[model samples]
Target: MGHVMQVYLGDKAQLEGVIGSKDEALLSRLLDAAATEDAVDPKIFRAIIDGGPFDEDDADEYTAAMYSICSILGGQSIDSVVFHFRSCPDIADIFYDWAFEDLLPPPEGSGCAIWTKENNAEELAERTADTGTDVNDGGEGDEVDDEIHWMNESLLAGKDLIFFWGV
Candidate 1:
């Protein structure tokens, strides 16, 4: 089996806030962790998330997607966001459209995809209604369902959902 997908919820504003802070050590560690695929130290991870927008408490470092979710979401090309992560406000919409309406197939290549609070919450609420499908049924309590539930929660909470894979 392939490695499970990992998802992180971040606040772009909070991350941007720390990008230029005076703590060079924090910035250095953040950069290093972001650039490497190895397991990050828990203390360093905590400090990094503390200064940045990453919600360590809710991060799903091991999702059930098994990396296949990347292909479903987009493709392996979006495997990294080391330094160029952007806020993709329409990602959830895109996923819903494809997963439900059968449109917008995954893009040609991948790097990283994100969905931020820039989208309308009311609209998301409308689109997020239970589809009663196995792909996203939250009743299973499985990692994939849990991950999806968390993604929805993050979006609803006005946070950003970042998907990084292929590492």
Candidate 2:
């Protein structure tokens, strides 16, 4: 078998298979925090957003909804979704914007990026590697290289790329 890159390209139904349903208790707590005008505790927020239930059909749409809900409950502007979520390092892992820097912009809160041969996926991967932020780097450079190679092969074969993170 060959190395595989962690990318997702599908509607909400497919994402549901990836992340699954939200826990009722977590939702209730988030709602309560909003009702009381209290900041959402980071731990609770992570639990809900990271692996929490997702009943929606479009991952992009659902994630945006989540950001809105979390932001409102936290009394922060929706525009601060990235900053607010990034404060939690684990949540930061959910955004793959770096991978799509010059490619098609991933929808905000959708957590998806597109890549194509025309956009130079190979060059982008190389640039990412050179910058030491290839998204596959969890202290494993060789593995990341292999993933880049896999992406190159896929793109060369005329397969475009759509990646999802943060779920």
Candidate 3:
């Protein structure tokens, strides 16, 4: 399947208004600015929330950019981050290669993943493998799965959230 992206303000239920509205212009620019890092930048200048799950097979510049946004906002204690794609460079590099792809999905059969700074490279790979099966399954978990829903600073900062969805 090809890639698709959608933005949101607060809840997934509100995604319809954004998918084709003027916000698409900002979504396009966010996709471009998000590419600034091969690794995600966690400042979350504009907080974001997940609107939908990305199909792993459709990993492309847009999805990678979404992943970048999530990775950064998912934590408050992380020092650095990395994504272990079986053969691709880190997410930072993926962001720089802004384009579409047919088969380059993230490792662990994950449509997208965010490895915190805590784990070593090997540990990160293992964690990715483990979380791929459990985290994305739509059940309660140790962490919030972006595949289902992701949150950012918008709620706390009182800024109107710009949520996102991928397809």
Candidate 4:
């Protein structure tokens, strides 16, 4: 299976905040598209979402739709390509936490870690691994703390489309 990246918009606060009318509308569209039986490209899908305003409900929808898409594509055995806006550090943390906790597996060579400007790859990797969670990038480039090395390799291979907005 080809590598797939799951991009989520909005921060922790925005995700938990009240839903907005515009965001609700966009999310409805995303859900509709994500539920389709046809193959979905992360690039095209993210473009559609990025074309409009996203809110907390949008975040939830993105998360749910991502899981659904993964299941449709096959299962968690495949690696995920993730991108998110880094508007708030807390939000970034929340996104990472959610990604690590819910979406991505515990490194285990099944997951990848793509950080935004707000994320400290080293620190996040260490903390994530310390929590008894397997993570890739734990110490240095060659360490291979966990199975997450695939993610680092992806980054080195020039997967630039995936990013965490540092704004």
Q: What is the C-alpha RMSD of each candidate to the true structure, in Å?
A: 13.5, 14.2, 14.4, 13.1
Give the alpha carbon lDDT tens digit for every residue of 1-167 in model 4: 23234432223222222223234454555557656745343433453235323333334334443444333333323233343334333323433433424322223212222333234345546655675444443564445432234334333343211222211
Per-residue lDDT tens digits of candidate 1, residues 1-167? 22222455555444334322455665455446445644443444343334434333422321112122233323223122223223443333333221101111232222234556555344345545554334345566434433345456675555665554433
- TM-score leader: 1
Q: In model 4, where do residues sit more than 4 Å from their true spots? A: 1-55, 64-143, 160-167
* Candidate 4 local lDDT, residue 121: 49
What TM value does model 4 have?
Answer: 0.27
**Native-vs-model 2 lDDT?**
0.42
TM-scores, each model vs. reference: 0.37, 0.29, 0.24, 0.27
Steric clashes per prediction: 4, 6, 4, 6
Residue 13, model 2: Cα distance from true site in angstroms = 20
lDDT-based ranking: 2, 1, 4, 3
Judging by lDDT, tell me the better candidate of 1 and 2.
2
lDDT of each: 0.39, 0.42, 0.34, 0.36
lDDT of 2 by residue, 117-142 (tens): 45547665676768655544554654
Q: Which portions of model 3 miss their true places by more than 4 Å? A: 1-10, 14-18, 22-25, 38-62, 69-108, 112-167
What local lDDT does model 3 show for residue 64? 43
Which residue pairs collide in model 3, if any? 8-163, 38-92, 39-92, 56-111
